[model samples]
Target: MTATISGWSAIVSPRYLGATVTLCLGVALLAFNGFLVSTALPTAVAELGGVALLSWATTVFLVFAIMGGAGAALLKERLGARMALIAAASVFLLGSLIAAIAGSMPELLVGRALQGLGEGIVAAICYALIPELFPSSLVPKVFGAESVVWALAAFGGPVLSGGLTETLSWRAAFAVNLPIGAIFIALVLLIVPRGIRSKAEGRLPIVRLLLIGAAIMAVSVGGLLDSPVLTGLCLALAAATLWSVIVRDRTAATPLFPTHAFRLDDVVGAGLWVILLMPLAQAGSAVFLVYALQNIFAFGPTLAGMVGAVMAITWSIVAILVAGVSDATRPRLIRIGPMLLVAGLGLLAVALAMGQLPLVILSQVLIGASYGASWAYTSQTIMEAARPGERDRASALLPTIQSAGYGIGAAVAGLIANSAGIAAASTPEALTGVLVMTFALCAGLSLPAVWAALAMTRR
Candidate 1:
């Protein structure tokens, strides 16, 4: 049965207030930081002079973040939730400081890597901490609140970063992280308790971790290099490494994932596939849309940011609304969710082809709503599907899968864009065609996600 709490009142009730604040701020910091950096990167590169290395600024953060997420459960077990958060915030602060003062591209990348690592740790811990901190009924509410915070980030981060970049300096965006991290740390020390440990104290899966990390890095690096041959090789390497991890884990005494995590017939496996494919499709569309808006439509950074905000806004709204839905209804929502995504992408393809700004924005809203409705349930399903001892790992897997999916998806999208002549397009018409192809490609990719979601309903 779902928790009895109704409406938004449950989140602010005395029993859950402190946990609610801490969780929201912890997650908000990560989301805000991501959008802030994306907004600031262009100005940062212009000032620092590493135009060619632009992608690395984002890639390094994601790769290490995935690594940190992979180890979050172990970190929490050894350090406790309070201390784990403290450590994460501290590292994040240090990274922000480094980026703030960086004089070169290399220095900025180092700072970004730290930021990613700390953010990864924080993201993993936040998801894992939810079950421990909140009642079963409120878990969905908490995740819904996370979507709200992310929406806030989407709305606020770009505008704020753009203002700072234009008026003061790009470095100011990085500087803002200092105060946010400090506040998160203070909240942790005050509201959260100490000495919470994991049920499974098994040793870290070093080999599997390395393999996954390599796969993420390979695909990310593949995105940066424009060579068709090199991209193909890197993707192949990434695929091989991932297969090895699955094969290796199948026989291990302590497997990284539960057995059902790899089986399509099981809810856990189906949920993971949904997690993987959704981000893959969304990120790909996002990359293409942002490029098309700015380059082809001549939209300013702030306007483009507002356009991007449509997704988060709808997502947040739907997440909250879906929280009140009954358990029996969620399965149907999950099955229908990807179809909505497919439909949204189809609209996006038309919008890009016609260069209609209103339609593009509407498509984003629909896509976001579809994602929000399903994500609330998919997240809850993953946690509930875990065996007793595997909850932490299950929680950690959600973000890990998400990060890996984005990295791979973005890389693959870049390849598709390049193949479609986006980089060499000489006119607006050529750019429009490229975007149409790209969105169409992304839409096609979501078909398998629909299959995955439907598989969850199987016996």
Candidate 2:
């Protein structure tokens, strides 16, 4: 039954109901955990007394998650979707339990790494399975609904974690993951088909995996340290290692990213650039924006979270509504989307300079809505450009690139702020100056996205 997607209806249609929920849960779990942990980590650090190792929680999780994403195709081939998801959920459950009962920072870090592995694998699987399970016409709808899950988690994760930490204990936050994991396992077993598994080909790329991990670690560790010379050295080393890995992959018989992925003129390449740059631009200030809200605007945690969520909330609603756009309108929307992102960021920079909270919130909504309007189409473009056997690899590319951009962006942003004296400034005037500088720089990043979108149009 190839039903034309008129709206969100395609997702809720009888044939897709089970698959829809299953896919949504796979991603929602990842998103929820990310936000929840960020909110609850302060309390955990306070209790465990590992303030110095605080950044390691996020750094370890991200590095392992990227590793999981890179190896996802192999896992799927070896275990099949049903078993793969089950394994991921079980690992996630174990990690949650370990973290919940952890006595020290090291123990929690180990548990976080495990959770990252599971989360990354599940996220990659969600993308890979979409093409396999759904009709082409309905794929956008599935992506839209998945974005909604992400948006909901963005809002809900912080609130739930904050409430739990304040009212109960930070341990209670991790305990909640138990039920979600259980439900995810049940849904996968019942709804997802046990498809025939193919023979796993090739040994795991041990050397390439090591290179990727080293690069991420070097950059991450470098970013955390206050020494400029060390940060520069680490960041440079990370760049060289990343470059070598990409070059090696390109020449290999089985590459992680297809050859087209590296080309600027190709559809997949353009879409991939859009994916990378959007996050790069946003990450430059996304973390700072939260603090700015509380520090400069004097918003409470709940209120600041709501303002912070404006982008995601608008993203979900816009994505849902735009799922029904006509074919002709999609191209125009795609082109305009990056420009809207530019506008949104620009407005945000202006809002920060003027100290207007409402404008700040409005800018976030525009930025989020721009993503909602553009991402599905860009993602589709990437998949469409992939060779038949390469779609699984393509599925993993967007998220990997996006995550890398985020990590790198935040690191760069910190350097920018530190250099500008924002890191040491105590006055509200100094805080605003740093934000203005940071966001203005971030806003400029959208120009490359515009260029990428234009490149896609030429093709």
Candidate 3:
């Protein structure tokens, strides 16, 4: 049985408030960075001139984020939480500074890679720190606070980041991170004790990291190739390389994933598949959305950002609404999420073809609602289905796997859009046709997620 707590005062009290604020601030930094990049990249492209390499910016960051996350626990063990956080914040600050002063897309990507590494380590460490900083009873409250931070970021990020991009140079958006990072570090110093250090078990899979990196780069450049045969070969190579990672990791000395991973016949495996594939399909909106809104519809940065923000708002509200859903009914919600993703993506294609803004907004609602309705339940299924000893490892893999999906998905979207002439789409009609094809491919990617989600409903 769980311990009893009458109210949230135990968490909100002055004793713990600074620590609480630091945790929330960490979440804010990551959330704001994501929304800001999505909203401002179009502007950055206008100034920096890399429309062809647009998706590469995001793909690069996600790849490094995954890499950094893989090593977070090791950092904490070696450095302790206080020093670990300080170092992470410093890295993030350096990345932001580099990005602010960047003159070209390639240089900006270098900054983004560093930004990804810093943010990735910080995100993972924040989760690990929860148990260390709070009593078991208060841990739930800490997580609850984190969820609120995410919701607030979803609501405010577009507004804040969009305004920064419009009123100042796009550089100002990255500059905003500097102050936030400073505050996070200050509070971390004042609040967190020097955590105990221990020897970390196992080494990072350097070979696997390289393999995934190569695969992402392959997909990122695949669409840019002039010849159809070369493009096809590149994509095939990416798929095969990714498959090999999964295949080889199962038997590795230091396994990258749990033993049951990717086994469709196993429930946890099904849940993991759903996690990976969902973001893969959803990356289309993250990559192409602002450009389409700005170029085709002539939306200002703030307005275009708001259009994307609606999805996050819808997701937060829907997730809260469904939190109380009976266990008996939760599986049904899990089953519906990916199906809605497929439908929402399909609708985006239809909206682009029909040239309808209202339809686009409606599709966004469906996509957001799908995640809100299903993500928690799907995660619960995976955790519940895991072998007893694998629970913590299963939990750690979720975010990393989700990042894998987005990184790979962004690369694939690049391939598809470039193949459809996104690199040279100067006219509204040309851009529209390319987006239509891109979303259609996203919809197809979403179909496999439906099967994975369906597997979660089974025994």
Candidate 4:
């Protein structure tokens, strides 16, 4: 262990316990909202009688979140972290209220969109604030603690969603956020000291931000549209809009993302690679597993959900353990993490081919552990590499790559399954074949991440 790690390990004493809890609660609220929505979304769609639009709810939030995260970085530069957090919390509260009271699907979506904006800003600020608040030696440990909160949120999110939907209503799930958001905002103001205000870099263009947000919303909502051709066109427009943003950023005096991020430094590039590959490997396998378990094994929704939770629980546990270790050895852990992921995915492919459920579940456990450790390591690595002031800009790209990778992976898997004579509805043989192909692709994509990890040490 390095001196830095040893110091951080010692800093988690009784005196700073209050500050630590406050920080964890604030970050956990953001993640709880994210996970809760995913759990309750199915029920929401069923009630609204628009099952086709189910995916839109998740996609739209992510799209808007990208824009919000970028904007928050800029806002933090102007208003300072403390004030920026206040603004984000307010927006989140209002959005939660809107979601809870919404009468129609469109209205509910509007609320969700607003919530996404708040989520994006708050998430970026959280990453940006960690380095500023904690000593350099303790930053990684703080981030690791945050990851534990995220894991808890991920584990608890679905269970809460299921319980809320079954007992009360889906509306209750959104309503729950109001009180939590309020409490967190209060705690942040009371606990965190106000620092020097951030020096502004002129003003951000509101019109440009709107254009980006609109383009993302169109892509997500379009996907929900029944017309296949229209959906394709919308996706094309989204792509063009993103490309324009990239071009503009290259030339702009103050870009939304830092210039070097796109240039791909060893740590940043490794972070991006993990962001892309982990999601692809995890999500693709997940969709396939859900199908195989429910169709092949004839499991109920409750049972299937429990099986899914196993992966998340194991991932969280591994992340916490690895994060607590010393920084000098962290780099090696990063390398091993991705390699294990690739190996786990490969094993899953073989298990699928052999028609063995036990083997498949075991593969999931390994993959989950790899994912947990990789996520924590990558997050810490990116924070370590970024310039002090540009942390938010760099961190914003991580989520964007993750969301994009998962979407692309799921779509590609769907196409492959359909083309291979598997109908949309699941069957034992068809699902088994889909799992085989999906795992194979995930294993292959993970190879590049391994290479990226190797490159990190050399740099």
Lowest summed-lDDT stretch of 10 residues in model 4?
A: 2-11
On the 0 to 100 scale, the lDDT of residue 63 in model 3 is 71
- Compose the digit string of candidate 3's lDDT tens values, residues 230-334: 777887898999889989988886665667798888888989899999999999887798789999999987688779777777777777667555568978999
Q: State how far residue 319 of model 2 sits from its true place (Å).
A: 0.7
**Model 4: how far residue 134 lies from native, Å:** 2.2
For model 3, give the 10-residue run with minimal summed lDDT.
Answer: 1-10
Q: Report per-prediction Cα RMSD to one decimal.
A: 2.2, 1.9, 4.2, 3.3
Clashes in each model (backbone N, CA, C under 3 Å)? 1, 0, 0, 0
lDDT of 1 by residue, 1-459 (tens): 123365567778887888899988888877999889998998999989989888888888988888888778778777887899899889989999999999999999999999988989888888887888886677878989999899988888888998999999999999999988898899899887886665665677887877777899999989877786788789999999888888888787657665677578888888889989988887777777776788879988667767877888999888888887877888888887888899898899999888788999899988998888898788778788888777877787788888888888888888888888877898989988887888889889888999998887664
In candidate 3, list every pair of residues with a backbone clash. Answer: none
Question: What's the TM for model 2?
Answer: 0.95
Candidate 2 regions exceeding 4 Å error are: 1-6
Supply the global lDDT for candidate 3: 0.79
In model 4, what lDDT does residue 90 have? 84
Worst 10 residues of 2 by lDDT: 1-10
Candidate 4 segments exceeding 4 Å error: 1-15, 199-201, 205-244, 424-426
* TM-score of model number 4: 0.87
Q: Best-fitting candidate, measured by lDDT?
A: 1
